[model samples]
Target chain A: MKAEFAHYKKEELMRMLTIMQTIRTFEEKAGMMYGLRKIGGFCHLYTGQEAVAAGAISSLDLSKDYVVTAYRDHGHALACGMDPKKAMAELFGKVTGCSHGKGGSMHLFDVEHHFFGGNGIVGAQIPVAAGVAFAQQYQGSDGVTLCFFGDGAFHQGAVHETFNLGKIWDLPIVFIIENNQWGMGTNWKKVSAVDDFSVTAGAYGMKGSSCNGLDVLDVRATIEKAVAEARLGRPSLVEARTYRYKGHSMSDPQKYRTREEIDEYRKRDAIQSFRSRLSEEKILSEEEWSALTQRINTQIEEAVAFAEESPEPALSELYTDIYA
Target chain B: MAEMTYREALNRALDEEMARDDRVFLIGEEVGEYDGAYKVSRGLLSKYGPKRVRDTPISELGFTGLGVGAAIAGLRPVVEWMTHNFALLALDQVVNNAAKLRQMSGGQLSVPIVFRGPNGPAEFLAAQHSQALGSYWMHVPGLKVVAPATPADAYGLLKSAIRNDNPVVMLEAELMYAWKGEVSEQEFLVPIGKARIAREGVDVTLITYSKPIRVVEEAADRLAEKGVQAEVIDLRSLRPLDEETIVNSVRKTGRCVVVDEAWPLASPGATIAHLVDSRCFDVLDAPVELVSGEDVPMPYNHTLELAAQPSVEKVIAAVAKVLYREDV
Candidate 1:
């Protein structure tokens, strides 16, 4: 981790903190709404691992670089520039949603912001990301594709196939694994033979590095290097040892792990850690932190109101975009 | 008109399209130096080099999904799936990704990609290789599924597929690859979702596509000799089926017989029969008859394979059955 991130800046650190704070606020509101039975269906929140999306995307040019992630994708979308209101409205199943309410929490797509989607199938985005990178390369554009998945999806065969292809073709693509300890009810160790996912990249002749996802600065710097390498036509991998604060979805009771285990990760929560670091470095005073918190709370409130006032899509729209 | 084999016409279409637009390129297994599995991409590697006419490893899902991504990212990638059988390996990428990306992205991204390959049963390629999954894709909403019956349609439809701003599945017939036909020398485009009447008549309407189209034509010729005027409609595009044409024909003839090289239950035959019955049943004098392949996997024996697929004899029998009471 030290060697991977030797160059770090304060503004970048502040930016990472801001992203994590926004995600934390948005996720907490979403979880509260889910508990109140206001938001229906599947709801996966990115709580313990805010830095993975925030840090990785910070190194990318949102106007050009493409971002694709697994179902646990709210954080990635927010980090890439999707308004919290539109994202929340989407989760609320409102027509004003990012995908016009067609996709919920599991499938968030905002192409205008260069956020491809929040794919549900395991390791499905690996090849899609490579394709995007291939297009960039074929068209002589210096763009890159950053693909993220979970440790559970890492076991999928398509992941390895894409890794090899991305390396061989030297396509500008990055594979990011958010190893959040558990896959639904099962742990990562039981599902995977080799626990070290970074080693998986060596077979494809690409550099693979590991980072502490709880540390926002470390994640930002590491992903910056990975994106740079990919931009040079050399694909790379970054295994972020993070934790999801909520269950796999709103449905899961999280019976596989102990409350104590959850508490242990919560002690090093990414959002809390960043807040503390910012205060310690005098970047933000306690009074300023409170004001920022108040501002984000207002934003969340307006997003919910905007969604509640929005109308549902008409029945005829069901078959509108079957093709372009 | 210029005479050429279906394979040559298809190759010419790709070469011409790629030369016409820098955004258009070919990628798939054995497409570059290997000259494609069927030599359809032969001599393309030397002209375009490895970057444009890329030869991919045996990773259909990877490359196909990459093609979808490339298309969505703004490049026209014509992906070759060695055969329709191999497409099963990449179903998730094609069905879930390529087909749904545009809608899912709120029309922000368009997968201008073509998943093309020789489809349907071919000789003794066995059960795995000979399965016809064209109807399976036609069942999908966002995908434009096109199966050309003649060399002219093959060339024109391919050019349209390349230029379409959506994902298209170009299912060619393996048996019809070497078949010779006359195609226009000038470039042309056949609009998708439109069906053409290969032979116009008044006794009955025969709906078919791909290899079974030939069988339907033969049956039409036989019926013409017997005073039965049968109109044969070769449905070039399956998904956006020209239902108006089939309904109008069935309404006029007062009878219909659907021919397909697939099994009877819920296949293309069933789809057409149901559509006609639901929309134009009152106009029909007799129940719509369907001539379909036997409900069994294609066998290695040439005779057994012929028996398993819908044949000219079977189509003739069905047409005769439909027109039995029409004439003395």
Candidate 2:
């Protein structure tokens, strides 16, 4: 891990930081758009969990590798190089959106970039992710897939089925659990019997590990190693211990956790900590840091403007894409 | 052309398609070394080897999603459910993910997969094991449902289903597997959403599909003996439903009877009866008659089960009602 971290030059590290900031800014704006009634229908923002997507995606080769995740997907989508305007336009239900506006917030997809989707159903993506890996194995590609889900998805029967399928087939995949502390309003502790995933790893007969998802460096290092092993036909399960700053969705009252707890997690905010760490290491100047922040803010603003100007899908589009 | 049973026709289709395209593969429980639950995939294991002829664990929800994923990733997967009774367990993957992926992804992904298995009643496999669940698949817009009656259709539709870009649910009948028919060795496709008139007549239209098509044909034959010509319309494709053929036949006959081996309420037969009542009402000489499986769970006793399901007598009785024949 030290060797891997040492090899990441200032240029590479800056790019990861840029992606994390872009996701944070993009999702914050999406939240605001939802509030203003510009977006509708079950919007789940990826506000605080940017590092897991950023670091994990940065470690994969998007040209061949694949990614799939649950509904909190704007972060994963942006990190996979999706144009923010297209993602925002999708949320706005515009024709220019990536899914042509039919699939709003929870169903984002870009097969060209190999981002499988924003699957809304909890734990459903696991078997689909395994299948994507099956195709990779069937086609004899060295591609490894990264599948993301929340702590809530652990209770689904589908995930358990996927665990068995993936292990038996020895498909090249990484099952990532983004332990963002809560599944909707319920705490993972109450619903889940086994919090430590090493036990799950043993039960499923797959290699497993955990990482500090708050640190982008750790996320990348852990995922990168797992991916390398996956390419050799050794599948794995990696849990990224993280948090979500926003409520589950804009509609959630979030009475389950305290503001103090959110503030406590915010102290270890992935973006702020990485920004400060880069400055102290003489990798990023304060002027450059503020300039990057200003630039990303402007980008998010433009994305919103794009959504505002984009056309709503025509009446005929409703009939199209229902088949083929 | 060759004489083959329904199961052999299905096996031949799989063998030929897998030979034609490298993307086509068979994956289901007992599809490999165990042959197949119904012997439909008997020799495919030796033909395509383990990579293509895969036997999955009894994880319908898991493997079905995997098949959808594989299809989305540009592989054609023929996933046999052994029996659609077990497919109930995997409905979430089929309804939520496979059927909706293309539309929800806004056409970026196409799930080119086939979920084929025996449906409806057979032997004494009552209640849960013998449901004609094709209506559920047809109820969804994104799916194309194919219910083949003959070996020729079993061969052709299965081949075409493998090539279709959208998801296809093939409703096969357990009792029909041993029914022999002439199938052409030279490949052909019985295009989805088309109906073939099994027996053309002008007196009355008998609309039916899979399993019950045989009984309907027998009823038509008996009607022919009685000097009353009856049209037997075999609806091979259930979803895009051969409405043109159905309406056209009803118009010609001026009377129609729908025979479906499924529960009556909102069933395919009722749907066809409504279509006839709506599309050919002006041309109709009599009210539409529906001969559907009794609105009850399938009973275990053979006699009770026959009473519960569609039979030749029920089809004839419905035909009689449509004809206004009071045994004069």
Candidate 3:
């Protein structure tokens, strides 16, 4: 833990904390907006797995590197420093949304930030992420890619194909599995044959590691090596053993897991633990903590206002993007 | 212009495009070391090297999706499926990603890729291999589907497909690859979304594309022997159907017969027949007859397979029905 804290400057750590706080605050407001019937379609919240996105992405050069993630992407999108107003407006199905309201909740894209998308398909984005890495390699760019997927995606064929391709071609990419323990009500332990992805990585001759996901510093420490290896064209896998506090989607009934199990993981909640670390390390005062929370709330309020004021996509847009 | 086989024309087109644009590349199974499954990419590996002329494992979905992603990231990839039959395995990448990305991303992404290889029935490659899958991609809105009937069309259409800023599905015929025709030595691009008047007449309009264009021509010749002048139209582009050319031809000729190597239901021929019936209903002298491959999986036996595909006999019969001349 001392070594982990030494790796990042105070400002960088503070930035990551802000990102985690923003993701938590943004999703909580999004859930409330969903209840008010403002946001429609499937909305998967990133309530519990904030540290994985904040930590793993913090280990990269965000200006040059690319990010592609699964459907539960509000956290990754914010962590990439994409405009929260655009993300909220996308969830609200407005013309000002990231994808102009065409991709709601599940598909946010910012070409400028290199946040490829909030791709909604199951296991579909793996090969695409590999392709993005292929372009960077083809162009001889030093940039590496961060590909995030759920534990459920490991069962897909494309994911296996990508693993083989990653090692064979030595693509500059890190495959991060945000194992939140559930595959849409089905437990990963029940469906997955292996307990850890290290066995799968061994089969493909790729490097693998696991991190204590509740601790943001541990995630950062674990993935930093993986990211360095990726720059040398040696792909690696880093599994963040995290857990979600809420049900899978907005309306999932919590029948699969026990409330005690959910309560157990929440005790080591990422934000709460990080708050303690900041206080213990003398990183910030109690008054500063309150100010940070208040600032995040104000940011969330502005995002909500931007979404509500945004208009619906114009009728002429229906056939516009279909061809280009 | 010089005489060349359909395969040579395609090879020349690929060579020219890869040389023309540094971003253009060829990728598929057996495309590099083995010189392509059908020799269409015969010497591309040697000329373009492994980087531009890539070879991949039999994982169609993986490579195809990679090609789409590469195109989205600003490379023009020509993804070849060994055959359109095997492409069925990668339909998810083609439909869900390639076709939907532009609209789904709300114009932030565009897949400038070309998926090309031999399509439609060829000899006794039976059941799975022998099938015309043009209609599968022609149904997609974001995709541009092209079927080349002549060597010039193959050379020109492929060049255009490689240059177009949209995803194109180029359907080449397996049997016609060795068939020789006049082609330009210099670079040329056949405009997409247009029809060619292969042979002009005033009695009946015989419309077809790809491999079935041969049978349609033979049927037109047979009609001419019986003193019935028949016009033949090769619709090279399937997605953006040239309705004006088709409508004008059928209206002027006052009769129509559509031919295709694919099955009838929901096929390209079915769509064309629908177009003619709806648009040129008042000018038609008879119902638009269709000569399509029998609605069944192609068989292994040579005779049964020939019986299944659009043959000269089938085209002649359909043309005779449209001409209303059973005795003639």
Candidate 4:
């Protein structure tokens, strides 16, 4: 982060840092909890990709703007004003969860905050997010839609088709590609014909840019620019160059990447970097930083307790929400 | 009242809706500037301007997905696919996004959009293009599929579909588009999920809709000449299927012949036969008969395409089979 680029208020910077720490802590706990058999089924932790979700959502107004993401969406949901407790309860598949136990870790839904969905299909939410934006534009609302997807989803035909529509309609949509270098087991170089992702946006006649997803400030600035462009009746694309520390999901043994490579990303840990910078700049005192961590940890613990204590939804609930 | 063809009724509906609401728009290939391939969206561009009445590039998937986005954002979009045959390219957006969004969000959002155009076996369109896949959409939980037969129904149904809160797949028959009927000049809306008894009879009920509504009517007229008073029930909607009309009509006549333009095996006809058999078993004097499109890909040849779909002859045969059943 440049000295002159640091225009954010001290309290705001501290708040952003707390969000990063909270995401990191939450994901770390999720990974451990899943490993310890406390959490079951599929869980994809946003361990290394914390800054990407946290930084981008920091610039968003949750009331109007919407979010639709791929399966690696727990962190995105939490950052988009979803209560960490409900999000965790959702992960626990409890009735108190965000989706009332219907959707597990992959499908955390918080409609009140305008979080459209955590879609399970690859590249599926692109058009859905666009539709939400289309409705907003139709109703004369200036609300924008943030559609999140992985590097893997770039190959899908639906994404390209949606990009064309978004461009033609001049929809207020920011397509955030969390290009964490790898699409599950395949590397970007192997799958994508062009090494640079910003070039793909040019195919759809939309402006595209790349930012360091590991740097929270860089992501925040880039998204701020993209969101502004989208609000002006122009859709834009931002390819965040980040990496995931964990395997694709909780079940994987992570045989695809080397331990040394994981260690490399760990050295530039987003949460640690943001926390250290804020603390060193006197934006956050040591006591305040400790208190933020303590609060987040307590919140996670309480969420776990709530999920554990909550009863399962009745058998009839399965048939209740099928239609209007 | 004014006389209007089914296609003209569709165009009039769009013109009226766009006049009423600025948010209402039409988008598809040949819809604008070209005055629509089937001329269903004629004069809409001149009426609503290019922004609302858009003529999209030949990208059904792209434009349909765009319509989904636009609808979610609050636009009332009437997306025509030239014909439903081309909608296959945009099935991802239609099936995955537009249909699933409301329920996927647990009713947080509503897709108040319409994907409208002619469906069913168009002549010589071959396997890829010719299909009565309204049942495919009916298999989806969140969608509402409406197929209107007459010019009056087309006008009323299109008006209602545009105002619907959920995403609607509206089917118009290509052959029946030019057929004319009386339409009211004032505001008119036909309720969805309801059936209209086109003709009344007593001996047997001929259940059908869309393109086959005409087929069954001709069959009923031909049967009337043979002293067979066959009742004709036109199902306007497939999703919230009008089982009541079919069951009651079958109970009165004690026999049914379900005529569908779609293929056999789990089709609308098969499903209707199942419902009638299950609900009105005791009331039925004879087993329900089904007449459907051939259980094969529609051939490209003109005669083969006609043979592929359920003809008036087939419906007549089905009615006769139910009327004088050896098993009964």
Candidate 5:
């Protein structure tokens, strides 16, 4: 862990911790808001899957690189530097939200951040990500696209189709599968033919690998190499074996899993483990940890307040975005 | 003006748009290298190179979604399906993503993409291959559906679709691809949502578009022989419906017969019939009649296939009924 931090500057490592903590806090608040019926529509909390986004997104150049992900995307958007206020407001379905309240929770877009969107349709964003990469290559840009999807999206026909095109065209895109073990309520193993999702990447003529999604360092290091390869007009797939601490959505009863299984994954919580690792390396002191926590709490509170105070979209807005 | 085939007009539109906009590119199955599945995109690969004229795998969902993304990212993509039948596989991306992206993104993104291909029955092409999908697309809100009947409209409308800011679905008539008509060499554009009065008269109105326009014209010719001057209104754009032109024609003629190649139920003809009934009710002397394809899966047998779709005789009969000429 110390060796992983050795390559990164103290400030950069602190930023990573800040991003991960922010994502965790933000998701927790969003879950609470959904429970209060403040955030309508689908609310997919990315509480336990913070490392996958924090690790991978931190490696790319946000100015030029693009990102598109599935519905469980609050963590990814925050990781891509979307303002928590705007994201929370979006979940609240306010005019100030990133998508101007037209897209409730499943679709959050910030073109300024080069974050394409958070598509609600399962596996729909896969080929779109490939197109983004294709555009990068067409324009002769070195920019890469990071396409994120859940393990469930691996079964979609578009995934294989995109994989083939991405590899054949050598498009600058890294296909990231955040294998959070479960697709909605059903475990992925029951639905997917292959136990290993990365292995399927080989059939598409691309290199495949997996990373410990629990370790932010592992995700960052593994994705850094993949992003580098993609920048050189090569496409690759990296599966991050992670888990979601909550149900698939706000409405999910989560009857598929037991408490003990949840407990097991929580014991190796990405944020907690990373904090402990930093403490052992003397990179963060107890006082510094408390201060970071305080800062993150304030940010989350401010974001919630902003969302609460934001206005609902006007009726005229219904027709504005229907066309260009 | 030059006399060119409908295929040449479409090809010219693709060529001109590709030349006019650096961001515009073509992609689909056999669009490149193979010229086109129907040779509609002939010589484009050589003129624009492989980068602009892309040959895709038989992955309709893949490339269609890719085109949607590229459109959102500021590139105008022209994605040609081998035929509209094959486009059904990619309908999810087209209807859900491309159509809804702009509104879903709150106008942060606009999918300026054109999906063009031959649609409707072509000779003996059977059920799977033969389908008139204009009404299917017109049912979707965020889509602009265009079915050009002639070479000029094909050239003009295809150019407009590529330049439009929204997602446009251009459904071409497969049988009419080789039909030659005069098209202007000078740059021109036919605005969407506006219908053209192909042949004007006052006895009865023949409202139709795409391949069925020919049927209506033939019906008009025969109606002329019987001393009935029928007005012909070609509805180039389906979704917008061009209700004003349709209503005005119905007002003048006091009768209408909508001829569509699509099936009868929930078809574009039904939509027009409903519109004419509601808006032009006072002006109409008789109820609007719709001559649509039979409500059955297109048969493989040539005779059944011909019977399944609208014919010249059917349109003439429908017109005769609307005009109360029972002895025709």
Candidate 6:
């Protein structure tokens, strides 16, 4: 861990920790709000999968690169520099929300930051990501697209089709599979023929690799290399073995897994592991850690307050935006 | 005016649009090396090169979604689906993403794309290959649907579709591709959401579009021989339907008959009938009648295929019924 930290500056490492902590805190607050009937529609949390987003996003050139993901995208949005207030407001279905309240939880878009969107359908964003990469290549820009999907989307036909397009055109894109063990209630083993999703990349004649998603350092290093390869006109697939701490959505009864299994994954919690590593390396002190936690808590509380006070979208808004 | 076939007119439109704008490009199966499956994209590869005239594998969902993504990223992409039948595999992108992006993003993004290809029944192609998909696309809110019945309309409507700032689905008739008509050589564009009055009369209004317009024209000629002067209205654009033209024509004629090659149930023809009944009920002297393709998958047998689709005879019968001239 110390050797890996050598490649990153002290401030960069601290920023990564802050992003992970922010995502964890944000998801916790979102879940509580949903229970209170404040946030409606589908709300998929990114509690345990923070390391993957935080690491891969941190490796990109945020000014030009694009990021697109599936519905479990609150973490990806925040890591890509989306305002926490806008995201929370979007979930609250307010006029000030990122999608102007038209798209509730399943869709969050910020064109200024080049965050394409958080699509609702399974594996639907895969081809769109390829298109974004195609545009980048067409415009003669070196910017790459980070396309994130779940282990469940691995079986979808669109994913394989997109892989072929990316390989044949040599589009600049990194397909990141956040394997959170379960696709809602179904396990990957029951749904997929292969044990590793990245292994399927070989069918498209592209490079494939896997890493520990819980280890932010490992994720960042693997993605950094992949991004470089993509910039050189090559596409690659990376499978990040990870887990999810909460149910798939707010209403999920979670009948498929047991308390023992949840407890086992919690033992390797990403935030705890990173916090301990920072503390042991003397990079962050006890007092500094407490201050950081307090700051994040205040920021989240302010976002909730903003969402609570924002107005509902006007009735006329329904007719507008239907056509450009 | 210059004489050209429907296929030539479409190719000219693509060539003109590609020459007009650098952002506009074509992507689809066989759009490049093979020219086109139906030769609608002939000579585009050599003219624009591979970057602009992209040939894709048989991955409809993948390439279609990619077009949507590219559109959102600030490029105008013209995606050819081979035919509307193959487009079913990519309906998720067209319906969920392309149609809903602007509204979902709250005007922050727009997908200026055109999905064009041959549609409706053609020759012996049955079932999956021969389907009229105008109603399917018109049902989607954010999309604009257009079908041209002549070479002039094909060239004008396609040019407009490529320049429009929204997602447009242009359904071309495979059976009418070789049909020729006089089209103006001067640059022009046919505005979307408008209908054309093909013929003038006073007794009955024959409402139709695309390939069915030809059938209705023949039916109108037959009605003329029977001493019934029939007016003909061509609905070039299905969505944003030209209710004004349809209603006005029906009010003048006092009788209406809609001819469509689509299925009878929950189809575009059904919607038009309902609109006429609701909006021009008092003005109509006779109940509206419809002539539609049989409600079944197109059959391979030539005889069954002929019976499954709406024909000139069917249109004439429907017109006679609407005019209360069953004795004819």
lDDT of candidate 5 over B206-324, digit per residue (tens): 89999888878888898898999999999999977798898898889899899988999899999999999998899888889999999998999998999998999898888878888
Per-residue C-alpha lDDT of model 3 across residues A111-194, encoded as one tens digit per residue? 888888877888888888888888888888889899999998989998888888888878999999999999999999999999
Worst 10-residue lDDT window for candidate 5 chain B reads B319-328
Ranking by DockQ: 2, 6, 5, 1, 3, 4
Q: Give the per-residue lDDT digits (tens) of candidate 2, residues A111-185.
A: 889999989899898889999999999999999999999999988989889888898889999999999989999
- CAPRI level of candidate 2: high
lDDT by residue (B138-246, candidate 3, tens digit) is 9988899999899999999999999998999999978889999998777778999999999999999999999888888887788889998989999999978888999
Among residues 3 or more apart in sequence or in different chains, the pairs in candidate 2 whose N, CA or C atoms overlap within 3 Å are none
For A137-177, candidate 5 gives per-residue lDDT tens digits of: 88888999999999888889999999999988999999999
Candidate 1's residue-wise lDDT over B1-328, tens digit each? Answer: 9999888888998999999999998999999878988878878999999889988889988898888888888899999989989989899998888888777766667889898999889988878888888877888888999999888998999999999998999999788898899999988988898999999999899999888887888778877888888899999999789998888888889889999887788788799999999998788877889888888987888988888988877787777677775431
For candidate 4, the TM-score is 0.94
Query: What tens digits encode model 6's per-residue C-alpha lDDT throughout B165-228?
Result: 9999998978899999999999899999999999999998889989988888988888788898
Residue A230 Cα positional deviation in candidate 5, in Å, after optimal superposition = 0.4
Candidate 5 interface CA RMSD, Å: 0.8
Q: Quantify all predictions' global Cα lDDT against the true fold.
A: 0.86, 0.91, 0.89, 0.83, 0.91, 0.93
True contacts kept of each: 0.67, 0.74, 0.61, 0.51, 0.75, 0.76
User: TM-scores of the models, in the given order?
Assistant: 0.97, 0.98, 0.98, 0.94, 0.99, 0.99
Give lDDT tens digits, candidate 4, residues A47-74: 8998998889888887778887888988
- What's the distance in Å from true for residue B202, model 4? 1.1
TM-score-best of 1 and 2 = 2
Give per-model CA RMSD: 1.9, 1.3, 1.4, 2.4, 1.0, 1.0
For all the predictions, what are the DockQ values?
0.75, 0.84, 0.75, 0.54, 0.82, 0.83
Binned by DockQ into CAPRI classes (incorrect, acceptable, medium, high), candidate 6 is high
Docking class of 5: high
Model 1, stretches more than 4 Å misplaced?
A1-9, B325-328
Candidate 1 residues A1-324, lDDT tens each? 233223556566667777888888999999998888768888889988898898889889977899988888899999998998889888887777887777788888888899998887888888998988998898888889999999999988789889989988999988999999888889999989887899878888999999998887788778888888988999999999999878999899888999999999999988887777676666668897788788888998888788778888778778776677
